[model samples]
Target: MLIYPDERLAVFIDGANLYATARALEIEIDYKALRAHFAEQSRLVRTFYYTAILEDQEYSPLRPLIDWLDYNGFTLVTKPVKEFTDEHGRRKIKGNMDIEIAVDMLNIAENVDHIVLFSGDGDFRRLLEAVQRRGVRVTVVSSNSTQPSMIADELRRQADQFIDIVDLAPIIGRKGPRRQHHAHYDEREETTREFEDAED
Candidate 1:
């Protein structure tokens, strides 16, 4: 991660995209540590995490993690996912948060000297360009080390700096003894995976 001591940094996280990327790399992020790591790099202004929730469900498995993040130095932005049938007559859930993240980044651009976007979505290339015009440096964090590559080429090119998340796993990822093999861990991972799968 490129860091300047005087830079005022803000983080915009595309929750589903990040979750999927991390899963593809077989790592789980420790949110608190990730925040602290960035804070150490510069004047951390804010960290925004955006996601979609299925409100119709009796209980959401992600509620615990969401609540944890909300109280742990993250600004949570979420909305209910919309369910609909496509032209092919297959059920699908719509929960894209790209606009929300772009809007927030634009709103905060003037205040922050740098933005670290945690997404590989190519749709954000224009947003990054707009933010750059305002003199804010943008750092995209996603992986190209995955089997098929997680970071979109255009998005990577648009960024002022591209930091692959796989390289930061040692600093931000959870350390444990084969976490995915445990039932409890699988339940939580599955919850995140379900939404991310729908997103992609």
Candidate 2:
């Protein structure tokens, strides 16, 4: 949570990874609150969210959330998931957004003073290094409070600033009446399971 008033900022969110982190922490993120909190911190330039969709599905549980985010200040980056059969003859879907997120951060590195990434994936260690080379300060937001610790050690060490999401829960979490066993929450859990298994 280090902040400088004049620094320009951009956010890159790895949708599935963030969802998993928040679920592990047992909190719901108020996207609006999150955007506003950072906007108040500095010159907020842009926010990017990445995910993969199953194009063949007639109905997707994540459609509502995805649509809401698209219309509400987030630039959505998505690709269709690819399905294939393994050698064992089991169908599997694969999707990964690391390259997309890295490209966007690198593309905008020179223009922004700060880049905030919302993912714990260790693969981004090099991406952070590259952006730091361009003089952009990188802040990684992920939790180390969970039982297994969602934040990767190498990624945490590489970031110029690391803010554990658990500490920001009070500021960014949704407030008022969320049932622990709500049907929507169940849907989200199911969606996470599918995506996590499919992720490459």
On TM-score, the candidate that comes out on top is 2
Instruction: Provide TM-scores for the models.
Output: 0.90, 0.92
At residue 180, what lDDT does model 1 achieve?
28
Q: Top model by lDDT, which number?
A: 2
lDDT of 1 by residue, 99-142 (tens): 89988999999999999999999989999999999999999999
- How far does residue 124 in candidate 1 sit from its true spot (Å)? 0.2
Across 1-200, the per-residue lDDT of candidate 2 in tens digits comes to 98798999999999889888998888888888899998999999999989888789887766776787788899999998777787888777767888899999999999999999999999999999999999999999999999888889999999998999989999999889863322255576765665667664
What lDDT does the true structure give each of the candidates? Answer: 0.86, 0.86
Query: Candidate 2: where is the Cα deviation over 4 Å?
Result: 178-185, 198-200
Error of 1 at 9 (Å): 0.4
Q: After superposition, how far is residue 117 of candidate 1 from its true place, in Å?
A: 0.3
TM-score of 2: 0.92
The C-alpha RMSD of each candidate to the native structure, in angstroms, is 2.8, 2.4
Residue 185, candidate 2: C-alpha displacement in angstroms:
4.8
